[model samples]
Target chain A: MGGRAGLLIAPRILEDVSRGRDIILVTGTNGKTTTSAMLRAGWGGEVAGNDTGANMIQGHVAALCASNASRAVLETDESWMAVVISSLRPRVVVLLNLSRDQLDRANEVRRIALGWRECLAPETYGGVVVANAGDPLVVFAAQEARHVRWVDVPSSWRDDAASCPHCTRAITFGDGGWSCECGFAKPRVFSASVGATLEIGGESFEWGLALPGSFNEVNAALALTALAECGVEVATALTRLRTMTTVQGRYGLRRFGGRTLRLLLAKNPAGTAALLASLDPEDEVWIAINAQLADGRDPSWLYDVDFDNLKGHRVTCLGERRLDLATRLTYAGIDCAVVDEPESLQGEGSVTVVANYTAFREWMGRSTPC
Target chain B: MLRVAVILPDLLGTYGDGGNATVLAARARARGIEVEVVPLAIGAVIAPADLYLLGGGEDGPQRLARDLLVEGGFVERVRDGAHVFAVCAGLQILGTTFSIEGDASYPGLGLVEATTTRARARAVGDMATMVSGHMMVGFENHGGFTSLGTGVEPFGQVLVGRGNDGHVDGYRAGRIWATYAHGPVLAQNPWLADQLLSEVTGESLAPWASVADRLYLERCERVSTRRSAGDRTAGRH
Candidate 1:
């Protein structure tokens, strides 16, 4: 229902319903769903959002139609952000880190950044853009906006942003973060995360989120900033965020085929790197990849991930592109057994299944109450 | 010890093209051949190695890599019989010129007698081709249509999807081989990896089949079947 027909009908639905609502649009290559969920959880007002990960225009319309709430926190796909923003006139736009994701379907990171710059020009979008100063591409985009609240989210994946999006010069990373020779550097951070503590306006608040990984901490920081920009108190936002346990099926433990498995979605190298960092060295890992349309037909991103992190662990590869993942694991010096079905990988132990988009959805659909 | 130099990977390796180098090192080590995988950054001195590899990248970086290689005098090394394996953008950068979007053409290393012009539509999908009687399966996602010169020989003929352009896939001239397939190309096609390794070592290596072989065959069949089904649907229409 949400293909061409949905896209065609979205503008009318948005035009009829989206006015007078305080919309906060979150967008990036990764973490759009999770961050939007976080923003919605923290937002005090009655809010509506596309929490099911349908981030396109049709998804926005469907989500807005489902609720008559005065406030909405919508996860906007990076490509569709401009169109959605033009229609919704979002009060706040949260720009997260931009990296290589689904290269077969999407434009390059720099091209997307250029689009964001044009969309968020002061004459067009006068809203406050909550951006990550850690990502050079985000900085490059948000710099064109009239007002921006820059948050210092740590970026571990620097491969895509190796060259400056502005000058195409090599960006050098030092103690202060990335800076290009062309005079474009990481923007001044308005909010920063330093070892579990979030510093905003020189005041430090310790946040212990239920979500795993430092990336989630960054997401929480972005959410807090966006919430604060929306007139919610920082303390109130933090309390609400703590109550949030899961985004979609991510971070949910489910019983499938007599084995307890935790679902984690890593669609690209950046997300995969963060997941890998969060894992215990001894924990058994299962990685599933699919070349389905939603998942992007190219599995070449498997090489971008530092699979060597799972070197000593027993790994199982599953999905339509299980062989691709298995081959990559072999080259990474990790031995992995390729399984055709998720049931074949079931064992009576705690297993973490890290999957890409469609694979995660497949597993999520099969998940039972734990 | 076989030294494999991966040239400017941070610039040219957007499509997991680094996996090609990884496959080379892994295949070499499996056969008791000691290997060192050297990742050469931009501005770094290029040292002679058993095999040199370059991967695919976006247009801006492709131009940057081409300029850097030219400035670093690495093109002469490729000409002086350095076993080189390049893919997609890497192949384009090695050609005489590559026409990017908006009628902009960038100068290439001219290591291969070919010119790449941006195609109106991008060719992106699973691709299977026959390379020297060997079935090679991988994925191709490129906008550039490379036309080889009359004197140059193609690496393969397309059996399923678009290769190089819509016809021939890659170029194979002496020690240099270039392709558009980046299933890392080597990870899925172990035979091609072995062939490149054999050329580097100056010895014909035996066919070393692993789990990758079965995976390659399965992928080939899947892509072939899908293409045929699409063709049939088109025919019916």
Candidate 2:
């Protein structure tokens, strides 16, 4: 509401508020929240971050208004990148990766990347674009920037980039890099991670981080790359990033119903699949899903998620779209108990509760004493 | 083994429509019919299969898929009585011609006597159609509003949301089944899946019941019953 009123009273309020601040704009399908958190942590103090998951005008305004900080990291929604970029005129724009999520709103991944291309064009803005060298779509969008720092954020999800965005030709993703026949290929190397070694501009940093998932490490990588663009030393960024833990309560352990529950929020196919893939095969998982508007009313994307990741693990399905999820799981030869309560599931040790948007919030509420 | 080829999932499987292949293969295997699901990526040769499934995609990939299908002997195989199930952009790709971004119109496979053009508004949300004596429930998300040519039979009457034109949704002529519903429509409407499986195997499938599907169907009923679920506007993008 404040963001809207500010916009109405003064159309260029976002521009006004963002003026003179060294802003690092993070935009991507996944890892935006975690990356923003990492950026804030890497920058240590005096850095404002919009990590509330809203990522639009409301959250951006609120975050910026709360702080008179000299530096800020604003996580903008992938779809809202165009609007935010024009106003913020950020110093460094960090793109993690691109994939289809919340299809009802952003129907096509290409369209979002296209929007980014338009906003990040040389004529539009001049800033350092730190993007994922692993994702072709990210490469496509970040290609227009004057300065691009490509960081290889290792991701297993590649179903979204089956074809080249530039020529619509089939792209071949080899162990080395991905390339299309139409001269569109992974650009010249900048930085990459080889397991525990984080490579940035011919230099290496320790890969050890306080974050749980490899996805978080990817977030840290992008965040580190963005900080590098902002002239922060690699050693300083790594030390600060490793000291921080937890992101919007993600991977946060909390006791619930006589058991320790680890909360992981995965709202889209890429996110859920990545979460599922990163989990220990023997670990018990409670998969919660919902079709609320924020979660993209269509739960059909659940099919795209490889439940096979949980093949060796005991699984329980719950939440609003549990039936759809359970139905999807049954076909994958994984028999999961569908329970109305996550507490009812027979599990030992720390139970990993993976839920999409509303389900995550609802479960967080349930775990928190009413 | 009955092979269910999910063609160009990378190009056209954005909506999780590949789940339909999983549902089909699993259901078929449970009925004592061995099945193999072949995920056909681009440039892959078209193999013999009992059923070929195509899902929704963006405009560029949709046209690329149509052209690839033409060059990959997909139409010839379909002409030989192979079963094909397509949804949304898949439906558009199998048709005669479809318009995408701007005023640009691209040629389709011409396998189905249909043509898709950009509508004033896109039709989205819960769509229902009474098919095979039951409500075939699914969600429609597409900017293209399809119109069937003469003599082409529609899959069902539009009971909830705007389908093919508004009064109807989808195309069913011989072995090919196409609709605007994005992905996993088969899982939502298991009867439709069974009907397609039965046609492919040339065997009668026994009645199969699933607690999850039953619950899903009940919810689909509840959603369709509510006026808020369907396209309140004439169409939506």
Candidate 3:
């Protein structure tokens, strides 16, 4: 709302708000919201940012206009990273792992990575980049950056990075970490996410936040490293990170239909697969899907998720695309039922509800915290 | 026993083509056929199999997979009476020539008499085609417009969306089946999966349509309705 008014009042709003500010911009496919929230919390002050999962230019304009704080941690959309970097000229840039996401809308993964390589060049961007080394796409994009502090944060979603982003040859993840036959390989790292800790400069700092999932551990590690780049001590950032519980109603336990409902959001295959692995196989989980404008118009990604993880669990499918979910589950040999509403679910356990973008907001709209 | 080799899934599985292998195995196993699915990685040794599946991928990986398959003697194996199923980039990799990154054409394995050039606009939307005397439904997201040579057989005619220049869908010759349809192609059409299985077993298998079948038929109806309603998608010139 503020962005529209700011744009009308002042044509050069983005530049005006971003000028002379210690803005730390974060951009990637997954974990943008949670990682942005983590960096904001680690900042330990009234830092300006889009905490409601809005990472677009309007959101950045609004956040910047709403606060006059010296520091702002903006979560940027991957496609808009170059524009934001050129205008905002942030002191630090966080480049997370890039993967396949929203194919109907954002189709080419390599195209975006290659664009990142161009904008992140030392001549264009004069900021310190805290990037992940394990992800070949991320490493390739950030290689041209002048100052890069690499973090070897491993991601199990390896399907998107099977080929080299540089030479277009097959990338091998053998004894040499990750390398193509043409010598495109992982850069040396300053930090590595070892289980629940972030090891940097031969010392380990525990960043076990209230957030769950190994991806969360990696997020916390990256967030703390980013905070350190902005002159914040590692100890202070880790202490503040522990205080973060839920991000935009995600990772919260709520009361719904006489069951302890755990709300989680996963929009794509990689995110959904990781979220599925975090669930208990013995318990029941509610799977919801919707192909709205925000959720991408294509529902082909439903087939990409590894629903075999729900083999030992009682599963229920709901939402606008419940039938699509049912077909996927039935093919995987997992017993599932389609329901129109959450209360129609046939179970008597604390259900874990994992939903896509729009379905998650719909489910959370009619529920409250336990 | 059925031996299915998913050729270099790591390189060519950008759009859930692994689900095709899974669906093929599940269909065979449900009918009491012992199935062994081998997902061929980059450095993995190429094993002889009754059938091989290739999936859709990006331009660079498509070329890489084409080179590896040539080196692995995959074309020779296919000529030795083995069945092959490919989709999108997989289909292009088996053809005479295919273009990528706009105007960069490369030689394929020459398994099919077809060529692909970078189209003026990409095609990305719901696509349904008629193949094997049955309706097949899947999503088509590609930038290449494949031109089939004379005497090359199309697996199906275009029923709904744009398919190989808006007339046909894919190429089929003997045991080799390639298509632009990619909901794993077989998962959405049980009859095609059965037909492939029957070819290997040398038996006309009975219809074993399940919930996925019902879902597919419903989706086909929905797509047709959307098309009639003037909601047809995919970028065109």
Which candidate has the top score in lDDT? 1
lDDT (10s digit) by residue, model 3, range A73-104 = 99988898888888899988888888888776
lDDT of 2 by residue, B1-237 (tens): 898999898888888898889889888988999999999899899998878999998888888888888899999888887899999888888899999987588888888889988988777677777775777778888887788999999988777778887888889988899877753788887888888899989999998888546755766666566746544434533
Would you list the rank order by DockQ, best first?
A: 1, 2, 3
Tens-digit lDDT track of model 1 for B29-52? 888788899998866788887789
- What fraction of correct interface contacts does each candidate retain? 0.74, 0.74, 0.49
Among residues 3 or more apart in sequence or in different chains, the pairs in candidate 1 whose N, CA or C atoms overlap within 3 Å are none
Which runs of model 1 end up more than 4 angstroms from their true locations? A2-12, B230-237
Error of 3 at A226 (Å): 0.6
Name the DockQ score for candidate 3: 0.55
TM-score of each: 0.96, 0.96, 0.95
Query: Against the true structure, whose DockQ is highest?
Result: 1
Against the native chain B, each candidate's TM-score is: 0.94, 0.93, 0.95
lDDT tens digits, residue span A88-153, model 1: 999999998899998888947778988899999998899999999988889889998999999987
State the C-alpha lDDT per candidate: 0.85, 0.84, 0.84
- List each candidate's DockQ score: 0.77, 0.74, 0.55
